[model samples]
Target: MLDRIANIIVELKAVTKEAKSLARKEILYKDELKKIKLENVALRGQNATIIKERDQAIKERDQAFNNLPLKDNPDNRKVKELLFANKIVCQQRDQALQELSIKREELLKSLQEAKIAKKDRDISLSNLDEVISKLEAYQNICQEVKSKISQGKRVDADLLIEYAERLLFEEELGSTSERKLDYLENSYMFTDQASINRSLLDR
Candidate 1:
């Protein structure tokens, strides 16, 4: 009977360990999802700005084309020269606008894919059950600690140690996540062909 009881206790410990591991994974996933959402919002803002620039480019190109005289009157050399110059400028603007359109399409596709991935992740998180209990337990522990601290009782060494570990883990995780996000954003900047074209046009 004692051997059987010992085996049950061991099994329980294993289960508890697995639960803790799952809880940690859940927390990490939540943080990652938050980061992804923030990036998506930023991407949307960029897309809006790109669209505005593209519209402006189109408008300028149209204005130049409209200003060009249909018939270059050779007798009026100055007028012919002005019209020819405007035509070249209009062509250049049109080419830049076409390139911007292609880049915008690619960005839209990427944004759509990201949205799908986020939706799938959200569904997965919603189906998860065990993490809620673990989170609640953590919150309860925090509340208890606060209550004890308020009542003038010194926090036990073990409790303080656990809190310290949590703080260290959070600090490390935050630092690493920010570094990773920064690198990813920087990498994307290099691939932003539309932004480069806009810069060139502005110059």
Candidate 2:
């Protein structure tokens, strides 16, 4: 019975160690998600600025075209140069808007992925809490068993030890599951961009 109790304590220690590791990973993933969210927000702001600038450029181009005096027979060369410059500016604005649109789409996709990762992290944390609760319950039972043993009671501490062992095993399983979920979620996020780019390149 003593040997069993010793093994149970060892197993509990291992489970707690794994739980701590999983908690650390959860924090890391949460930080990464925050970074991605910030990047997405910045990209959205940039896209909005690009759109506003494009609209302003279009308005300016229209105004310039309207202000030109066609009947003045002015130096057509100057008019032509102004028109050319306006066209170039308008084209540049259009290109910038187009690029901004593409970037916005990419950022939106990344933001969605980050949200999913955050959800996974939350779930992992919830599981960890449940495991912690179970560990506390098992610890209480072990204390009771130790008191009985001290009183010279022929208590079957084996039952308490076994229960603790089961609880510890469950905790380990939860930690493993959480780790796997985190890994899979992160892997999907990283690979999604690569997969899309590969398909585009192929096309």
The model with the greatest lDDT is: 2
Superposed model 1: Cα runs more than 4 Å off: 72-203
**In model 2, which runs have C-alpha deviations exceeding 4 angstroms?**
1-83, 165-203
State how far residue 18 of model 1 sits from its true place (Å): 1.3
Model 2's alpha-carbon lDDT is 0.60
Residue 113 error for model 1, in Å? 16
Question: Per-residue alpha-carbon lDDT of model 2 for 60-142, expressed as tens digits?
Answer: 86676668787754567766866787687768767766776776677677667757766775676566566556655555555
Q: Provide the global lDDT of candidate 1 against the true structure.
A: 0.53
Q: What is the lDDT of residue 90 in candidate 1?
A: 60
User: Model 1 misses residue 28 by how many Å?
Assistant: 1.1
Candidate 1 structure quality by residue, lDDT tens digits, 26-136 = 667666656765766666576666656656765675576567777752447655765576576567656655765665576567567656656765655553333343343
**Clashes per candidate (backbone, < 3 Å):** 0, 0
